[model samples]
Target chain A: MPVYSEKVMEHFQNPRNVGEIENADGIGELGNPTCGDIMKIYIKVKDDKIDDIKFKTFGCGAAIATSSMVTELVKGKTLKEAERVSNEVVAEALDGLPPVKMHCSNLAADALHLAVEDYKARKAGKGPIGRVETPEHDENEHDLLEHA
Target chain B: MKIINFDHFAATKMRPEVREAMEPFFMQEYGNPQSIHTLADEPREALNKARLQAAELLNAAANEVIFTGSGSESNNLAIKGTAFARMDKGKHIIVSKIEHFSVLNAVKALAKLGFEVSEIPVDKYGSVDPMDVKNALRKDTILVSITHASNEIGTIQDIKEISKIVHENSGAYMHTDANTSCGFISTDVKELGIDMLSAAPHRFYGPKGTGLFYLKKGIRIMPLIDGGIQEFGRRAGTENVPAVAGAGVACELAKKELKDRTAHLLPIQKDIVSGVLGSLDEVYLNGHPEKRLPNNLNFVVKYIEGESMLMWLNNNGIMVASGSACTSKILKSSHVLSAIGVDPALAQGSLLISLGEDNSLEDAAYFVKELPGVVNKLREMSPLYEEVKKKNKV
Candidate 1:
């Protein structure tokens, strides 16, 4: 793979908002068992805005970078605005992930969405957020598996 | 920052002595060994000398060594080559779960060609059981290729015992990719009682694109690459004369300095292993405690991924390898860790550190001191870790 962009390397080397919110409005945890990367996202909502956000990622450098970039992208934005965040945007924020590491951006996006979903579900009086699994994987997953 | 090279399993620097030995062949003695000119004399002699040095190291005759492009190619040549040559006899081949990609893919390719493969499993330490090897064999099983040591986890298999079981059960040819253990451990073909073995020169401070496939005399193999008579016509191409000569010197040096090299490396290995395990929480070593390579250390840290750790280490100028999916070819989990029955999530946490002659005690100490903080920092941010912490409290 080509060298990661300076932005990606920077976020990977020094991730931002790398912690959890105590008494959080909602929590989201996502895992890609095959790739052995998992993420847990914490959110604090106020006045319909995601007042604060933080994340912890247990995966590759790209995953951590994406998680960090996602938190920065989503924080202070309204929940609806945050929902507009996408994998491409997260990757773009990093300048670009190596094509192989693009899925890590998906994982980051999924975790953020799941956290938002959990917040909505709690307001609707759902008991607790359970672990979510995305069984479908892209073809790129196979390349990283075989090569890495 | 000083870079501590702990990815020797992936590749190594060519020794200066080996480079100097190969220098003449690249210029003055640049004739192809296949040519009948006087220029061929020097390369031919160098090839001959390399063959002998490799043979001496493996305790085999000069005729047994056939140079090849890479260790992976040598494995392809050994497994597929043998199976094709003996297809009329049997079509069954057996390889353990932790065999390198070269061996696994070669076997899989054979499977596509109508050959049956029995994959033997490994224990938690990544050690393949000899009894399992025995059980997996059948009358039609013609080849059993198990790695002598796992490059990922550093677990060394008991090839002598496995070879005994393989031979006793069937008329199977035993081949081990002993590249990881070539210099650090004993890989004598006679002592191991194996019929074939593959090794890469680059693994032991030799040139890349140079390796050897040890085919026991009278064990026929259909060549993978065909052309003019080279590698005794088993592989057809002009020999890489410089790499061959370089590899020969590297082998000679490895044979003489194996003990001292081991002595120099084992302490750093021990310090790093013990230090990391001692300072960390919920972390476990991946390979066998006693039977692992002296310079190898593999581990799984719970509730985290190896890539993050690798990044941290790289920032500190320490190079290592990870078993995380994102670091792999297809974003799939490590088969070696899974074969040992580890949870896939935990497998993402795998880290391997291998020592080279260049590493020192202080380097080991620096890694040991820095590793705990990285793990703890990642864990602290992990909500799963918070859940676990909460659950543990309850």
Candidate 2:
């Protein structure tokens, strides 16, 4: 069996904040179709502060626990504070992640950053940013012609 | 409630009966099977008896079964041996996209040797279409190798149908890697129309180092290894007597318990499938619903990575595999998942739970009950979840 830290497992078994905010201030969806880890972050901001945070992840357990821990760490923080929450901080919060699973924490952090950024963008009347385009490779004709 | 554990997948708890049966092999009957002395006769008799027992399980003659160091070696022998021996006849081979790396990589090696290979595609459920095999055939195609059941997705292919197709079209030899299917499902080489079949004892509660390959009578394949006259000169090197004996016992036990064990696994599999999928929205099943192995459950949870979930499951004392257990170290998604056209996001989140005979309904219940909470927690910090929600405007 793969070795996991007890704390990571505990958080996974009894996750802190689950489900989505009904009228979330901003929602962030970050998924690299190429890589397969998809994360959706939901946040409720009130008076320029995060009043609620929740998530629904469909990946590995570390990703789930990392996302769960992120919500707890960022709840009640201002949007800027939440943006400052790094993947390092999340990994540290979970004790540590295996080298291969570090990407899961990174995804969690990126999803959080994207969600907060989306909120700020809407608040500034700039609206949400459009879908970010992934880097392109020309060697594969099928891939090039796919999005085109 | 009892505290649950997940380490069972890595190593099974030995049953008292199995342990008792293996006791004499370690000391009292430790003589070499190849030796002719009186002391060696006991071990030799035991070895031959085990061989016959193994053959009986597969419905083949004892001489037809050759022991190998591992399932991988057996697979290598089947593919490489056939390709090299029949090069004068043809150099073309056929396999499904979802085959284990053992089969796929062997084919690749053959390709490097100027042999043409055609990889047949599978549907979303990982079932290979026999007609695709028929269409991909060429007059020069010498072998059609397909796995009896998929290791990643748990889909059982119709080997009989594919074997018939190969025989009718090109008269090519039909082979199957039955490592993942042998004991849990009935295997009759002749009935299935298979000319070659490979199996690993560890997959059926036997020893890890013991494996078998069956080549029907009149079929000639070159030996990949060269040395002594072990295994009728088909394979070389001293036999792994103890492991082979253990494998024979495992096969016998599996045969005796197949009915009860299969029935026991069904509910656990059903619970896991229904519990996790029912609780989570947009989750998709990766393999066939009904045609899956009795003890296997595979799912693609959208937006999350499988590695992360596996780590979390590990933390919770619930051990399971994600994607191909062999390819877990690689950052890339499973080739099996990719072959089935699963979306990359969902594919990364794929989880494979292969239940052993010992796994219980309670284990399945606990896993299902806790899975959604884990998914939700991951999503709470996800930017992708937020974006999708905003786009949906709910």
In order of listing, the candidates' clash counts read 18, 36
Output per-candidate TM-scores for chain A, rounded to 2 decimals: 0.87, 0.80
- In angstroms and one decimal each, the interface RMSD of every candidate reads 2.2, 6.5
lDDT of 2 by residue, B227-308 (tens): 9888889998877777878777877777777788789888888888888878999687878978988877778776556666
Q: Which 10 successive residues of model 1 chain B have the least lDDT summed?
A: B324-333
DockQ of each: 0.64, 0.28
Estimate every model's Cα lDDT from 0 to 1.
0.86, 0.77
Score candidate 2 by lDDT. Answer: 0.77
Worst 10-residue stretch by lDDT in candidate 1 chain A?
A139-148
Second chain TM-score per prediction?
0.98, 0.95
In candidate 2, stretches whose alpha carbon ends up further than 4 angstroms from where it belongs are: A1-33, A37-148, B1-15, B324-327
